[model samples]
Target: MAFRAYGEVQQRTAGPKEIELSLFRQITEALEAVAAVETPPLEAWADALYRNQQLWTIVATDLVNPDNTLPEETKRNLVSLSQFVRQCSNRVLAGNDGIADLIDINKSIIAGLSGIPVSTVTEEAA
Candidate 1:
């Protein structure tokens, strides 16, 4: 299909950063969409959560890899953030309304990936 062809082209052309940003944007949107509905279907919520967790797991793995180029402090922060995401995801899965934090965290990472300063993102949100 044309759509599949386009996706393949995009995948080949996108740089690592762009690919990461796109993925975060997609997963974040999925979570936000499910959160917006009252009494969202459990299956839908779980699917979104699983995607998010998988994304974070990949990120955490890369952060710990010896070849990762990020500074130590940045890696530490990301690992901690990943841990928090995992805990929050567990709470959400247990019938708690704790998805907002996950969404916000993803938005922050997206902003960073998009080259927006952290202060600017927080100011705009506030």
Candidate 2:
């Protein structure tokens, strides 16, 4: 009951962008946690990667929607990024250790959504 109430309150209070940022943060955290495990169980790794892939896929789809308000260039860039995410995830699932790049991408997106300049986030990461 308490959990349901909290969720209702949160939904009412958080705007769309805030909710998107929060979801990205949560999915990124899951990916990070799995990556931190030195030899994470296959199931755990797959679950994290799957979640991130799903998130990006949804974002890409939404970007192309006719009702989406984003500029064409921005939508194209994001859709391209989402494609990269999907390809990288495929590589990772095929035994390549490429999860770090995906995590960094998610972090960059989170930073952008949080109103921080992406270049600043990239420089900080470097």
Candidate 3:
């Protein structure tokens, strides 16, 4: 059974890996789109970053199935991403820092999800 331990969710429901992978793909695609576009609008980029946070949080919360085993790193990313997204919301959106930050966070998130290392995602960023 999925249970919250020490304020961190822990459990990997059936097919959670698949859902995580799909979410990662979405993030990657968004980054690619932002990269390919010629000077994508600040609003568009900021919006993309915000949406990226939405996607990551949904996955962390288990979009496809119950996910109980979210690592400490995942939890931290989830929180940070949420905050960054919230900060980006309804703003003038005049630069690409938001987008760049989102991209970096996404890469680190995927690395953590891939079992590379959880703390690696949050170390430098935080």
Candidate 4:
């Protein structure tokens, strides 16, 4: 009985959208941490950036599924954005750019997912 209760709790916590939003938040927080340090650990920054890329890859894959309920244009846009994320992540990792842009993108998506007005979300990092 205890195991079954735990399973139910896990299910509640791991709903697809919830999981995505959680990951986005995690990535955002990680990036913020890296940015705060004088000399951030490359491994930690790489790990967080890679996780964000992986999340977008999953989103792109799901968007391409026939059973996906989103409108065609929406799916297309999301897939395009995912591609951009992949490219941008590589550039950021290569020291060609900062992670601020990536953090902004994730925060925007999180605001959308949370059904909150983007304007109301504080622009503060993390």
- Stretches off by above 4 angstroms in model 3 are 1-14, 41-47, 57-77, 88-98, 117-126
> Could you arrange the candidates by lDDT from highest to lowest?
1, 2, 4, 3
Each candidate structure's TM-score, on Cα atoms with residue i matched to residue i, is: 0.91, 0.89, 0.52, 0.84
List model 1 lDDT by residue over 1-126, tens digit each.
999999899999999899999999899889988988988888888899999999999999999999999999999999999999999999888867569889889989988898887677656645
Best by lDDT: 1
lDDT of each: 0.91, 0.89, 0.59, 0.83
Better structure of 2 and 3 per TM-score: 2
Q: Give one digit per residue, the lDDT tens place, for model 3 in 1-126.
A: 234562233234437665666577576667658766878776766566666757755754552344556566756667666666545543325553435555565666677667777467546444
- Give the top-scoring candidate (TM-score): 1
lDDT for model 4, please: 0.83
Candidate 4 least-lDDT 10 residues: 117-126
Query: Candidate 3: deviation at residue 33, Å?
Result: 2.1
Off by over 4 Å in 4: 1-8, 122-126
lDDT of 4 by residue, 4-119 (tens): 99868976878888877877887888878887787888798888888888888999999999999999999998899888888888898788988777777787888999999776
User: Which of 3 and 4 is ahead in TM-score?
Assistant: 4
- Global fold similarity of model 3 (TM-score): 0.52
Candidate 2 deviant stretches above 4 angstroms: 119-126
Q: For model 2, where is the 10-residue window of minimal lDDT?
A: 117-126
